[model samples]
Target: MHQEKFSKSTRTNKQVALHTDVVVVGGGLAGVCAAIASARSGAKVVLVQDRPVLGGNASSEVRLWALGATSHMGNNNRWSREGGLIDEIMLENLRANKEGNPLIFDAILLDKVVAETNITMLLNTAAYSVTKESANRIESVNAFCSQNSTYYSIFAPIFTDCSGDGIVAFNAGAAFRIGSEDKYEFNELLAPEKANSDLLGHSLFFYSKDAGTPVEYKAPAFAYSQDEIDAIPRSKNIGAKDSGCKFWWLEFGGILDTVHDTEEIKWELWKIVYGIWDYIKNSGKYEDVENLTLEWVGTVPGKRESRRFEGEYMITQHDIVEQKRFDDAISYGGWAIDLHPAEGVYSEKPACSQYHSKGVYQIPYRCFLSRDIENLYLGGRIISATHMAFGSTRVMITCAHGGQAIGEAAAMCAKLNVKPKALLAPKLMSELQNRLNGLGHGLAGIPLTKSDVLLKAEIQASSTLALAEFSQQDDWLSLAQSAAQLLPFTAGLAPTFTVQLSAQEATTLTCQLRVSIKPENYTPDLICKTIELDLHAGEQTVSLDFSEVELITQYGFVIFLANDKVQVRTSAQRVTGTMSVFNKVHKAVSNNGKQIAPPNSGVEEFEFWTPERRPMGQNIAMQITPALQSFAVSNLTNGHLRPWLGSNAWVADLSDKAPTLTLSWPEKQTLAGLRLYFDTDSDHALETVLMVHPEKRIPFCVSRYSIKLEDGTVLMTEGDNYQTLNTIYFKQTISTDKLIIELSHPAENVPASVFDIEVF
Candidate 1:
């Protein structure tokens, strides 16, 4: 008899100990974004993902759609595209993965993370253990890879828990909650009446391919029969045309813990899925799926709910539904409060309940940092929020935004040698916002007051540009009703209104500048002044000089006479908080690819209104300085990106002549390089495949340009450009007090526009 004994020893060379400024757990979109944000901010980030691929649920394994503020433009929130790392990801996906192919998307995310110089990506590494310096701070995370048989000990100044399950935080004893919270606890209307451990459950989606011939499907003995799934509402929504996330409701395990009983839930979902396919193929019920066969099914379920790490601020349903503005808000969400029934697909009810907001809402900095844990920052689905609030925030793009915000904060904290809580300070928070905006992450309500050269410089432009334009359907309505557009203005600022008017024939138009006595109600109260204009049949910019009128409140109402002799400019492109009011024209008007018609008259004013074609967000077409700042060339120097919603490069008047922008400074500053941010139709989130997409490109981007500096230096002469941010580095230090930029017509032959320009 021989006794065999196996000796265990560390792969002396395989044992790896790596130190970084930020260590991010989980390689989903959130973790990847967090790592990228931190790395871009000059931190060495070590990204650890348990899966072989990135994107988590959005990967090929789960094949979930990466949705965010766009939310398929389902309801009130329109033209809202996520920015920051997520926007970058969407842009890359649209460029490379137009067909919504998961494999290609996986490669895009992987390539993005790898492209960052300071990011070290560790794939197939699962964090199972944590080392703590104190009860409230994590020292390091220990992870193991079964594939490579390697043990990794990663150390960092800050740790981001983007793991959907919050595994690292759980192991590190970070404060957390599981399942739904009672309504009474958070004063949330959507919460369950009583606190319970029931979760939103897991979903297993399947993709099918169509063969030339019929494909037969057989059900396993354990699969459900037709009668077994009678309670499900599949009959109403299911169809052969559906693929990818179409079968997302084929879920179960709400009664069981999502994490504790994952395998059991997965098996049940599999049986249900196969059973459904069998029924469709053999039952002779769904003729459309006759040639379809199951090509792939997600074994690891795409989870909807799980452990949530507690943070200093717990986002509630009220904050989301009411569109609450938080001073510390770092990111925004507008997917709607989508809550699935606890019984999941088997509930015989709608898969989910959705309540949309009027606009995007904020997610504060406190939602990312752990309430008690000093170094831990929560991200993705694990961010501190009541289950009711998570319904909207759980979407991948919003999660990615949160990840980016936390990553930037973590990097700043590491640089400053401070804790995650330190960023909550007002000064640091403002700095964080500036950094985010500087990186072109569009936070809707946050303004780029700092780092905006136009704010301090004496700015002038080639022309007072109109970001959007509207056509006149009919000039005369034959009604006495009035019309006005609600504009959000600062109380102290003297706002100017540039009304673009069009007429069928030469006619006169009268408009009264009215300020709402009740700021919230938009009722035309005291008439500040009345302006009469004589206009031709073509488009013209009529200046309603409200610069003399100091707005008493944030909103100043502009009332128009219902003569209908001339039509005012209106577009579907909606400004965030501003709206257009038509007393009688209740018919919905389309603007910016969205419907802008609000319902009939309300007792109070401003309740039902549409957005003008002018602009929204920081920029408006009305040509108000410090108010509608979009008309200035300095908008090119401001840090905002994603040109739609009036956040864009200043567009010159449409003419045969090219427009020139000159940058003049007081001192002769030596500049090394020039960064040009051009408009690339950031509004549409251009997809790689435009089979069903509306716009291919924004058409306003500057595709061709010429630049000449002082002292006979021709820099970037006649350069053809197609990117969002184009950098032209000068070979030598060009010492000058002024530089000139000539933007020629784009390839599309539209007006030349530039979003931003920077010299360093």
Candidate 2:
């Protein structure tokens, strides 16, 4: 190669022009999901990411865990995992990289993107400019890749900005808000008394490992002095065993512009990180840190709040706290309204203030569409939400769930040859919701419609679960705190529940039968009945009969008040739609047993009844006088998935051998695909990082299954399944009058359960 002669003028970099149906900006979990969903929905997609890897805050560079509605299962929301593409990604990560290694997570995301043939992924490319066709619509986006010295001009009919900072929409002239709104503006009591410029800050994390010998560290010139470190109110929280996001409060630059001042924030965070490390190694405060060495430090800080674009509707604090239902509901969120102080690590105030809602609230499609730029779609933290509401919706997985909806909407827009606003029509909105729910995207209160074949078929199962008893096992748990067994009930007289208990001495146990004010919610806010039981020193059975009280069809909590002297028997058996919850606090999320908001704060006060993590959260051992027959084979055609008004899933009895479900139709029908929904224990929080899950595969998820025709010819078989949605497309259409699905129990104790089955 020869060098060119020096000239007075400069040469331009290589330029490339591309066209696609949908263009998704940013490669965070939200954008990654947006691109994948768009590609799966039959749209050509171009994914542009400024970083070298996907999963922005969740990437190795930042190393923040991807969390959403489940809120680490620290709140009242049960079976509340966000579904669709994000769920698939999390399950895949759990299968291959249960250790939650950041590097492994990055590879998994890359693998998922590359597997989608309809998607064109561009890494290390940042979109900096937008070209508008008119005053409202975007014609193309201009981006550059520093590594390749290339400029890319991508044109698309629809554009989705999943960038955390709303870069694309901002450049396209989209209206946005930068700071908290005034309390009177939206009548949101949680809002600041007056409009403020303060915002959540950016944070950096570091990891350490044992070196087995003394390791020395020296503070750099820019590092903070001991006095400066001492100024931080939470400096005492720093410990030798903690790493990564545990120090999420180690933030800075909230008082400044998060987007423009990111560099300044990074430098300050670095100074703090290195300074903290120096103190641990040389300050001689931490004895266990003698053999520890710094394993890694984040190169970039994880940004919390930035530019929030305006859409057709701006979700306010009321919508979240009141569990408002939207006519254009497309997705849902259950994480608490978590907000941090502007002073961050240096503040004397608590690290964060979080308030949880009574239940999961619905998010409308209108919030995802930009009001100013016609073709623009806002996603992630930049979605149309006020500062108070964004605190709950800004989490990565929640944003990813909304991103899937945006991607599907983009596909619909291209198909209909219309703008994002046009989807607001009632009929069109219904279509969008139907399409999203069909793909296993969880929308609160929206049930799937039965397929034509399922509508005409008669479903029968080999055996169905009758809630007769949970046999008492040797395992007995102490009543350290109040514990309750969540059980489904019919709209009639409450059944008699007999529980086995043992006491150190004679003790009186107070039992209360409670239900949520809303039937679909899990929070036990309404007391249905109460009973008093006397326990003996030895193991004895106590019967609680609420026969005098009539009840509506919903989940009833059989609560036993805390009595340290008594112990309740627990069964090892795991059920698909059953769990045991306790009234306790998860200090990690600021849940202090119960929430008591300040007067006129507009936030409701409620007790947090959360479940214990698995390998320990066993069901209570109890027997029903008249066995509850709710898990019928007919539930497969009931439209609803998951546990709603009742157990919508068809669960086979644990005693049944070779469990099978048969669907017979009057006439032969052509079938090309079959979709099965299994129970993945949605209540369990499958956190994407830091926290280690008790099991790689959800204990209730079916591990092996087979589909066959009436003639006993096997159509397909999945041997190592570990997901909620299983779609099996046949190589060729088969005409059959009857279909038989043979299932294997996920475990010996756990029964075989399925939410819904669709044939097309």
Candidate 3:
């Protein structure tokens, strides 16, 4: 295959053997994303990876579910990953593939990478070495393929090392740190007393399933006893099936060398897994269920902690716990500081600590690129950061975000043909921001528009926006108290990076959004330098301008308001309303006239009736009712309203003999027509069916009845269908003032749903 392919290329005789815009090494989540983003932006990209599949640690090898910080489905913040390329991929997988869950995930990643026009992925490819002649700019890379048993050469203008081990940067001559450093290095409160060999460790997670039959296992000698296995504690149970997998299982990292002792850890875990199962079935402590045994075991050990690269910025634990904000914040991680034991399971270090912040924290773009490597962009676990900080930033959701960040960075490098390091300045970063937003990657053009952002007069609760710092001190009473933060920020060492001015001339008030990517969430400090604005006993308009400021190190907007001491107000509009994000009405699909009774002979057909009111957003109701109903559904997602009685959209009640219009939507353009259902009930209930319309308003034709006999006599309508009240032959256009609905017509014979009517 190589010789045949080479002959074709040699005939063409291109002077440059291997040349491209960007070379992305490591076909993991971050690598694929970077390659796709760069290629989409008109850059030629070469994707190289040693692994067979693309999802990196979160792949079929380990079978762990994909998660992001802001993409959680339920109201619970436990599973949110800010919806992005990853979320879109998961949805696509759910729609198309129905193989086992792991295979489904693998297919999703493959489809995204292969379908892209600009990415050329080389699988089963390994990077033997990276030769960087400039120490700053990446010149080219050398890779070996096991499939062909041959070595090849590849050259690209820009390079990215998303290998999760920081291998690309390490080879690029970039400085990085691994494990805990001296506490003085970052002044982090969670740092160990001194630097050590400890890392967060890794796990090989596989679903525990028994295919319909229980298997008897011969317990291994090294397997942990039932007591010991149970002692591990099902501390973190996630996913729909409750897949028992501890992400921060750092025990192996401490008990054994994670990098060198991978095989040993696997050997030991295999023994422990079977022994635990044997004891569960034979121990007689619990009732045995059918097919209750380990279903699948992970072949690849999911690596949690690896190497770190040096970037333009370093996020710290203090930044998270303190709720710091930065101007260059390209992303935000909503998960708690889910740090496992720094010193393995049996060590002296605490197992974990809560990342209880005042609110969501932003991830600055500074952490995306290596400071030393001018053109090389890094992401995911390989992003530059100290070990203690990596603990909070290394989760899947944040890593996915890091993927997007570096992806955008690769795109910018190729588009401008400039070193990524040169783009770190705020001026160039704005352009990057525009690019990311365009691809639907960064915080640009959020579905919530500027007009969608509701500006208000006053907040009822005062301290909702104060810059209150929570350390071991302030209780996390804020989110429960008001769901808003009112932090009174302390100034960082600076020459006032921001200046805030109120509109009022008489009163003087000012605020400065300072620099400091730590303490206060590494969020740029918005310090109120002065409080002299127009609050003349009433409402007034005031604005603070930071448009002139050059740098915003972290992410998130600085909302500034002025008051005499303070005024009550509620600013910032939530994407969905206050009740709940699940206020949607599902339109039940109709069966082919099978479940519904036929309309009378005189009537053309029956259609379902419903209000055009949309469901109100975000709410939970145990019972559906008129006054307590929700109607905030989107324009396309069930904008029509259903009866508050129950989930039945427009069911025909078969209790009466007559089909009379208790309620029907008026074919009018007024709100009255749409809101009539608010006060409707069984009085407005249909004994039969109402005719559905194509417009927002539904027209329910009165149910008329007629039936023919074998003797040629018929009870017919005097309406448009016949000339006389009684007729033998059927004609056209039947009409009726009252509907002959099938009431008391046995519960089994009634048609519950209505769509459109058809006349034969």
lDDT leader: 2
Q: Provide the overall lDDT of each model, using Cα atoms, as 2-decimal numbers.
A: 0.70, 0.90, 0.47
Q: Return the lDDT, model 3, position 58.
A: 61
Candidate 1 residues 346-394, lDDT tens each? 6876776565555678899999888888999999999999888888899
Candidate 3: tens digits of C-alpha lDDT, residues 316-339: 766765546677777666444545
In model 3, where do residues sit more than 4 Å from their true spots?
1-17, 71-80, 94-100, 219-251, 342-351, 442-575, 579-760
Give the winner by TM-score: 1 or 2. 2
- Determine which window of 10 residues in candidate 1 has minimal summed lDDT: 597-606
lDDT value, candidate 1, whole model:
0.70
Model 2 alpha-carbon miss at residue 98, Å: 1.5
* Residue-level lDDT for 279 in candidate 2: 77
Off by over 4 Å in 2: none
Worst 10 residues of 2 by lDDT: 444-453
